[model samples]
Target: METAVADRKDTLDVEDLAELCRALGHPARVRILEFLKKMDKCICGTIVDSLPLAQSTVSQHLKQLKSAGLVKGEIEGPRTCYCLDRERLDQFKQYVANL
Candidate 1:
């Protein structure tokens, strides 16, 4: 029973890490993150204008980034503001270093 519990916990951790990695699997998502890093904060429309991709494409990438916990989004009335989750990114960096 103890071993089963340990295995389950390990599985969950692996899944979580894998999900984050998968979220970053696209080049567009990486570019979006880079763009966000340069700004204090941004909205979806601004990101769409900066990138060559269409608005819908940028939105998809933003969705993935937000889902990964690498980006934080706040609604400002009609618009959703976005910024990098620096702490989470730092944690991911440390995880890679340890690996």
Candidate 2:
């Protein structure tokens, strides 16, 4: 579900923040974010290699992050390179700070 926040450079609204929190609710998803932060960029196989979860499970977590706009993916040849959306994450932090 796209939101006005997705198109704007401003902060996320109440609903968007709630959705982002839910997307980050899972521990596995948190771990995936941490792993991605350390890498310059990563592919699905690399993420699966770093985590204990199965490839499919990791993919699900990635999907959640991507959908939430926390991460961005670009297809490169046979794999998709994933990276943290640092600006959006910083915006999330600011939103949480005000709360």
**Which has the greatest TM-score?**
2
Off by over 4 Å in 1: 1-10
lDDT of 2 by residue, 1-99 (tens): 266656563443777778789888999888888888899588888999988998888888999999999999999999999999998888788778968
Model 2 ranges with Cα > 4 A deviation: 1-12
TM-score of each: 0.82, 0.83
Clashes of each: 0, 0
RMSD of each: 2.2, 6.0
Ten-residue stretch with the least lDDT total in model 2: 3-12
